[model samples]
Target: MATLLHQITIDAPASRIWEMLTSRLGLQAWWDGTVSIAGGDCWRLSSDDLESPVTLKVVEEEPDKSLEWLCVQGDPDWENTLVLWTLEKAKRGFTIRLEHRDWRLSEIDLAAENTRWGERLMKLRLQCHHNDDLPVNDDDLSVWT
Candidate 1:
């Protein structure tokens, strides 16, 4: 089993980033629109562009700093697995560390996911910096807070 870890530094404050992490609209902006954290377990996670119903769980949540979820009942091979988003405070901005701890099928898969997330993280920072909600990223990267 291999773990894929990736981190991005955002030009946004820790608290500002936290709101986007816990809010519904914020979750949809980056994580895809298929989220219902406060709605409870078995939250649907289907993308607006995809035609499948995804099931996920909010395994844990820490105020303004962290949010963790289990994809497909936390099954690694199932793809959704364990996704953790952590926010670390810095002198200028905050570092958003995202990890998908799982048995990776290939290094390319890991790299691709991280690269894509890197772009999204950049988008997140840009959107937040402008105080805008339009992410323009496919995944949305902001669904709940």
Candidate 2:
């Protein structure tokens, strides 16, 4: 088992960041994919880079504090994994801590996954900053080809 952790400091309020993490519209703004509601606190995330849609079940949520999801479907390597986001108020903005855990080591390429997550988090940060020229589908890092 392995856990991927990353952190970023965004110049935004926790409420705004929380919306970006919890809302479908907000997600589509930053996420490099289409986001749709799967009903009952579940979301379906689909991207050209992904073989299939990932179904994420909201396991825990605390407004402006934290949000956690469990991957219930999609890639076998992703199933049963947890994606968590924790937000803390900072002197200038908010600090976001992300953890993607419970990965089966043998089934995944940790380096690739880490890079992907890092890119996604960077998009999240850019979105929170209201960057008009967001690379929603642009793979500047050339990692999602």
TM-score, candidate 1, is: 0.71
TM-score of each: 0.71, 0.86
The alpha-carbon deviation from the true structure for residue 116 of candidate 1, after best TM-score superposition, in angstroms, is 2.2
**What are the per-residue Cα lDDT tens digits for candidate 1 across 57-84?**
6778777788887776422344556778
| Poorly placed runs, candidate 1 (over 4 Å) | 32-38, 41-43, 48-53, 73-80, 132-145
Tens digit of per-residue lDDT, candidate 2, span 1-145? 9999999999987767876887776788778989887775788888876678899999888788988999999977788999999999888899999999998855458877888889999999988988443334421221111
Q: What is the lDDT of residue 47 in candidate 1?
A: 51
lDDT per model, in order?
0.64, 0.81
What C-alpha RMSD separates each model from the true structure?
Answer: 5.4, 7.3
Q: After superposition, how far is residue 109 of candidate 2 from its true place, in Å?
A: 1.3
**Model 1: per-residue Cα lDDT at residue 141:** 36
| Clashes by residue pair, model 2 | none
